[model samples]
Target: MATPQIHIVKVQKIYRTANREVHALQDIDLEIYAGEFVTFLGPSGCGKSTLLNAIGGFSLPTSGTLTVDGKAVTKPGPDRGMVFQEYALFPWMTVAQNIEFGMEIQDKPKDFIKTKAEELLTKLQLKDFRDRFPKELSGGMRQRVAIARVLALDPPIMLMDEPFGALDALTRRTLQDELIRIWSEFKKTICFVTHGIEESIYLSDRVVVMTYRPGTVKAIVPIDLPRPRHTTSPEFNELKNILGTMVMEEQSRHQKAELAGTTAD
Candidate 1:
């Protein structure tokens, strides 16, 4: 329906080296609708991040196609903004300057950039830290600035690669709530990659479970729970159990593969 905002068909990514070839992703066909929040969930080496990177145009697939709004995704564009596990802020710049960096590069007008930066500072709860540098702020505040920098461009799709994974649990939860608020207000399609089962359940409209290396879509589980989901709720735990089982199966496969590779070596 509505010509899915991001349409991926048979996407596969392979990394070739002098000694070996690694198939990072395989047969990844997914259709993400506009304004929907989706998470790619699986174990390490499952290619979830690889898939996200392909969608973000940080890397290209070896075969198949990924398109946004019916056009091929050959490179990164302003339509998509990416946040990483590492707070990728300019260490030398103040919070406000970091937020304004992208717009400045785009040659946005001085007044517009200033106004937008101020709005983001207030909206992301970073008003007091506006003049602080990255090192001066806490992990959570740094991420907020990173997010603000992305939002300054006002991308329609947000690609977040475990943006909260490095923070403390309490901080992670706080950022999750903030992200949900932002998504609700902006109505942006979000493609997030994470290893946290509960985090995926809490954030996504659908959880895409992936297989181990040479990743394939094992199952796409729709999260039907209402918003502001509670982790302890019976419904939440039930879905968590299902997803946890699927992820465990893949992780076992990954471990077996690793052992076999070691033995062969």
Candidate 2:
């Protein structure tokens, strides 16, 4: 087998303060191959985003290591691009300028930056909105810009933390389809964090289900369904139920904790 593109080993993360230590993650060891789509699925506080942040070099693990292309992930680097839940775009910059910002930061030649921006705008189907500011665009359009901005640098790995959670179902699925198309074309190793089981089932090659707090991998469910999957098909619904049970277990755990806290109060 080919060596893994992203290697995480024995990863543990603990958040310490003057009063308490919050154990966020433990015993996480995963190898994500090049050009694979993997989704981390779990409930709130399950460390799904925490793990993705660690891989993006935005969060430091209290123990163990995260590496990309044989390099230790100490801080945010271009090799791993991140798309957050929010668009994270500059309010003042136009779409073209926003897309070209990274290239400009790298001091690429003016012509190169312009060409790259045009190419991305065309690819994302935002060519007409090149001069428009983010506020002028709709939610879906803005997200397309956000994704185009990330792809500007051509990172081998894309870390997305619920990038579609805010949009309505129709738009969310539309973006999912757009993302699938983009991933198919570029084949970037994408690690996405989501709570929706069906969304996870639709987008991922494998769904890594996480448990409740101090989270660790509870299960890794492989998805063999074809592209443009029928959400109502027997095969797809069967996998959804299987994944749903695992997720509901954690959710039930959370509810019990909530009820216990209420009783204590």
Candidate 3:
């Protein structure tokens, strides 16, 4: 087998407040390979985002190690690009400008940035909106631009934190198809976090289901379904039911914890 591109070992993260410590992640050990698509799925507060952040080097693990291509991830770097649900684009910049922003920051040659920006604009079907600003576009268009901006950097690994969670169902499914196309064409290693069971099963080579608070891997379910999956198919529904049960259990645990905390207070 090929060596893993990302190796995480016994990773843990703790967030402290004045009165208490919140353990966000605990003993997470996994390996992700190059050009693979993996989804982190679980209930709210399960540290799915935390784990994705750790891999992107947005946050440090309190214990254990995270490495990409044999190098420890210490901080955010060009090797990994992150896409958030909020569509973190500059409102002041045009679609073209937003796509070129990263390359411009790196002082990439103007010609190269222009060429790359144009390439992504066309690839993402944003050529028509290149002159528009973020506020002028619809939510779906804004997200497409956000994705184009990230692709401009050509990072080998993309970290997405529920990037489609806020969109309408139709738009979400459309973007999911777009993402799959990009992944297949670009050969990127993507780590995605989402609360949608169908989304997880539809997009991932494997779905990593996390437990509730103090989150750790509850199960790593490989999605063996073929591409262009039908959500209503028997096999798809079977997998969805299984994942739904796992996530529902964790959510129940989270609800119980909340009640206990409230009682104690």
Query: Candidate 1 on 1-265: residue-level lDDT in tens?
Result: 4799899999989888777888889989999999999999998888999999998998989999899999999998778999988988989999999999999999999999999999999999999999989999889999999899999999999999999998999999999999999999999999999999999999999999999987999999999999999999999999999999999999899889888882111
The lDDT of model 1 is: 0.93
Which stretch of 10 consecutive residues in model 1 shows the poorest summed lDDT? 256-265
**TM-scores for all predictions:** 0.97, 0.96, 0.97
User: Which consecutive 10 residues in model 3 have the weakest lDDT in total?
Assistant: 256-265
Residues 1-265 of candidate 2: C-alpha lDDT, one tens digit per residue:
9999999999999877666676779999898999999999998878999999999989988999888888888999777888888889998999999999988888989998888898999999999999999999988899999999999999999989999998899999999999999999998999999999999999999999998877899999999989987888999999999999999999897678677762111
TM-score comparison, 1 vs 2, better candidate: 1
Q: Pairing residues by index, what is the TM-score of model 2? A: 0.96
> Candidate 1 — which residues are off by over 4 angstroms?
262-265
Global CA lDDT of candidate 3, please? Answer: 0.93
Cα RMSD of predicted structure 2: 2.0
Selected candidate, larger lDDT, 1 vs 2: 1
CA shift of 152, model 2, Å: 0.7
Off by over 4 Å in 2: 262-265
- Candidate 2: what lDDT? 0.90
Model 2: clashing residue pairs?
Answer: none
| Stronger candidate by TM-score (2 vs 3) | 3
What is candidate 1's TM-score against the reference?
Answer: 0.97
Per-residue CA lDDT of model 3 for 1-265, tens digit only, reads 9989999999999988777888899999999999999999998889999999999998999999999999999999778999989999999999999999999898999999989998999999999999999999988899999899889999999999999988999999999999999999999999999999999999999999999988899999999999999999999999999999999999998889888873111
